[model samples]
Every structure is written in C-alpha cells, then in structure tokens.
Target: MGKWLGMCAVVAAAVLTSGAASAQSGFPSKPVHIYVPYSAGGAVDILARTLGEVVSKQWGQGVVIENRPGAGGVVASQALAGSAPDGHTLIVVASGHATNPFLYEKLPYDTFKDFTPITLLASSPNILLVKADSPFKTLADMIAQARAKPGSLAFGHAGNGTSTHLAGELLKGLAKIDINAIPYKGGVPAINDLLGGQIPMSFNNGPESVGQLQAGAVRALAVTTASRASFLPDVPSMAETVPGYDTEVWWGLLGPAGMPADLVEKLAHDFVAALNTDQMKARLTKLGASPIGSTPQQFDQKIHADYEKWGPIIKAAGMKAE
Candidate 1:
C-alpha cells in the first residue's frame, strides 16, 4: 500500500509540472489581429499585411488586418488601447504616434501607459511630388516660387499631425516660406487631388509615390530625409536646399499594456526574424523603405525620443487637432 501511494504521488507531481509548463508556454490560442492606423496600400498598412502573411503562415492561424484610418490614427489607437493584453491584438503605427500627444488636446489612451512597444518595423522618407508637367522643375524653382508668393502655394498632407504634415511644417520653418498646409483624410485622397491639379504639390510616402514616380506621372522635387533616397538617386534631398532638414516616417508594432514579458519576447523575436528575411528586405527595398527590426526597449526609446523632440515643434507651430 505504501509503494502504491508513493508511485501515485510521483505521477500527480509530474502531471502538475507538465500542466504548469504548458500553461506558461501557451500563447496565441486564437487568430492574431493587426490594426493599421493608415489606409490600405500605405506604408504602415503594407508592413502589417506583409508581416501578417508570414506570421500567420508560421503559426498556422489567420492574421487579420483591420484598417481604421481617421483623425491621424486616433480611431485605431483608441480601439487598440481598449483591447485586452493577450498579445493577440496589435497596432501598427507610424511616426505620427509619437507626435500625437502634442497635436491633440487629449488622447483617449496614454501613449506609453496603455501600450507595450514591440519593435520598429521600418522607416521611409517622405517625397515631395508635383504633377509631372508642373512648371517647378527643381527644388530651387519650387522654393523660389514659394518664397516669392508666400501663402499662394498650397501643399496637401495626410493629416494635421501626421509625419507627412510635420515634414511640411519643418520645411516651412527651415525654408522660411509660407505655403499653406492642406490636411487630407489620408494619403490616397491627397494624392487624388495632387494628380488632379487641385494642389500645387504634396508629400507622399516612398511606397505611395513610387508607382507614380516610376511611371512619370509625378515629379519628385526632393526627399524629406537628410540623405537622398536610394531609389530616387537623382532627386535632391530637402536638406541639400535647406540645412538641418531631416524627417522620415517610421512604422512600428505595439500591443496593449501589461502583456506577459515572455509572450512579448516571443512575438518580438518572431517578427524580427521575419523582418530579417531576404523576402521581407526585397519587398521593403522596392517600396523605398529600410527595414528595422529593433528590440522592444530600442523601439520604446525611439517613441519617447520622438515624443520629446516633436513636442516643441508642434507647440511652437501652434498645431491643433483636426
């Protein structure tokens, strides 16, 4: 009787240990949902969808993409902030996320307090584009015209606080020009008007403008990045014309706050692995974006840094929410 009791006790302990291990390791029992703050085909959306395909395949579960574009990502961000911290739902946001606090009077969720940083996925320069037949042939000609007639020229952007908009504001300050900033609901609508000749020029993400640029439908005046874009080698950077000018839209992944550290590590590792793949690199290269698979801490630091860096600029510009 004693021997039987001892063997039964050992079996129970083994079962308990196995159960604990399974519980601790188990994650993603359901499909993953990635929320993109921008419209479809935009850089952020593309990154989410591309990564979703690979991640879903790896996990053998569906990775759904939900596009909730509005108010410079406020809508999607609010939804994400309200979601559970199960690591199954995530939000892919752009550089605008960092500047949102300064742009808005109040946010539904605390930027850092309500979210967990996953990784910085990629970064791309915003290109200043004009209709292929516009009279402004070079960056100099465009700047000269703007300087000559302040407020006469109008440029369209995705939204008031978006990276696209900030790039324009930065240019306005550096170039000391007074071109009007027109805010659109998203990049596609802005591009629509830009192509239709309703606006003199507009800022577009690298991927958003690549097709038009390659097809000769629009002419790139200058890139917003400090350096010239590799894809548009002939086009000069705004920094070339205006010293100290630099801006690039970046995309990163984040989840609801309070996710398990182990789960966060697992998710980050898988996504970083995907980002390092040759397939992912080639796709991003074609879109004129550079892939960055940074650690969670690195991404978190970038968020804080940008939030600090742009607060002064947004406040000085007196930018208000749209």
Candidate 2:
C-alpha cells in the first residue's frame, strides 16, 4: 500500500507541473481585454486601440478596448486589480498612474502592489505654448516675465495632477518663479483658452499642440523634456534655461498583480514585438509620440521613480482630486 501511494503522489506532482506549463504557454486562451482609463479619442484610448489591433493580429485573438474613464483612472485600475492574474486582462495607463496615489487621499487599489508592469509603450513631450502673436517668444522671455511680475504670469494645463500640470510645476520649481497654474477640464479647453487670450500660456502634450503648431496658430516656447523633441526640433528644451527640468506624457501597459513570471515575460515579449513593427512606429510618430517598448523590469523602475519624483511635488502644490 505504501509503494502504491508514493507512485500516485509522484504522478499528481507531474500532472500539476504540466498543467502549470500549459497555462503559461497558452496565454490569452480567450479574447484579451484592455481597459483604457479615459474617454475615447484621447491619447490613452488611441494608444490602446492602436496596440490592440497589432497584438490581436499577432496573437490570433480578439483584443477588446474598454474605456472606463473616471476618478483619475481609479475606476479602471480597480477593475484591473480584481481581474485574474492570467495575461488576458490588461490596462494601458498614463504617467498619471504613478502620481495618483499622491494626489488622492485614498485609492481603491495600491499603485505598485496591485499591478504587474508589462512595458512602457510610448511617450510625448509637453510643449509650453503661446499664441503665435504672444509676447513670450522664448522660454527665457516667459521666465523673465514671471520673475518681473511674480504671480502675475499664469499658465493653463489640462487638469490637476496631469502630466501637463506637473510640467508647469516642475518649471516653477526649477526656475524659481511664481507662475500661477490654471487647470482646465481637458487639454482642448486649455488650448482654446490660450488661443482666445484667456490664458497667457499653456502646457500641452505633443499631440494636443501639434495641429495648432502646424497651422501657425500657436507657437512652441519650449518643450518640457531634457532635450528637444524629435517632432518639434525647432522648439528648445526647458532644460536649456532651467538645467534640471524634464517631464513628458508617457503611457505603459500593466496587468493584475500576482501574474506568473513566465506569463509576464510572454506578454512583454509579444507586446514589445507588436510595438516594434514598422506600422506601429509610423503610426506613433504621426501621433507625435515616440515608441518605447521597455522591459518589464524597466517599466517597473519607471513607475517607482515617478512615484518618488512626483509625491513631493504633488504635496507641495497642494493638489487633490475632487
């Protein structure tokens, strides 16, 4: 009887190991769902749909993009956190994902603990823009005016805790200037106000500002990156005046926590592969974004780094979500 029981135990162990292997190798056994935490036609939604199309073709599985826009991405984030650890469910998150914990008093899920980083998909620089006829021809002109008048100069941004808002704040901190930050419901409204002369300047992402730039309705004073953006080569970087300034609107992929390491690796490999295609590269460039298919480890590090980098800035700025 003892010999028979030992043999049965060994057989069960082998079966369990084989099942695990099969599960890992057969990722997305069903249709994959990608939740976008913003409204359609937005940058995050566009990115999700664009990538989903390529990934679906590669995996031979349907990729569904569900937009759950609200509460600074908490709604969709909570949904992702509750999903199975299998690679079938994922979310495309923005840079705001890293700063939400600091902006809100409470979140439904833990930022780092509730998700597995898949990859950093793409990024676009924020442009400090003014009307073409505005007096601020250069970043230095804006900084000088801010210093001369103190709080008299103001810049508009998409919303509180957004990448554009943070870009403006980072400028204030590094330049030691007091420029009031005005928040709008969306980037469109902010840019509209800038053009209408309701705001002197606005910080907008590359996609949001590109049309106005090409039409010559708006002028780019500086891009909020350490170096000049490839899409707007003529625009100088903020770091030219404030040596340490750097910020951009970035997006990445994440899945529910507790995903198997091998599954994460598989998802990362497939998604990175999809992102590297010539089609995806050209599409991203048209949207004024640069494709960045970073490894899981690198994406995780970015989240942690941004979390640390923005916590104090959010707190110091006294920003909170309504």
Question: Once all C-alphas are superposed, what RMSD does model 1 give against the true structure?
Answer: 11.8
What is the C-alpha local distance difference test score of each model?
A: 0.83, 0.86
- Stretches off by above 4 angstroms in model 2 are 1-23
Residue 276 in model 1: shift from native, Å? 1.8
TM-score for candidate 1, residues paired by index: 0.86
Candidate 2 deviates by what RMSD? Answer: 10.5
- The per-candidate count of clashes, in order, stands at 0, 0
Pairs in steric clash, model 1: none
Name the top lDDT candidate.
2
Spell out the clash pairs found in candidate 2.
none
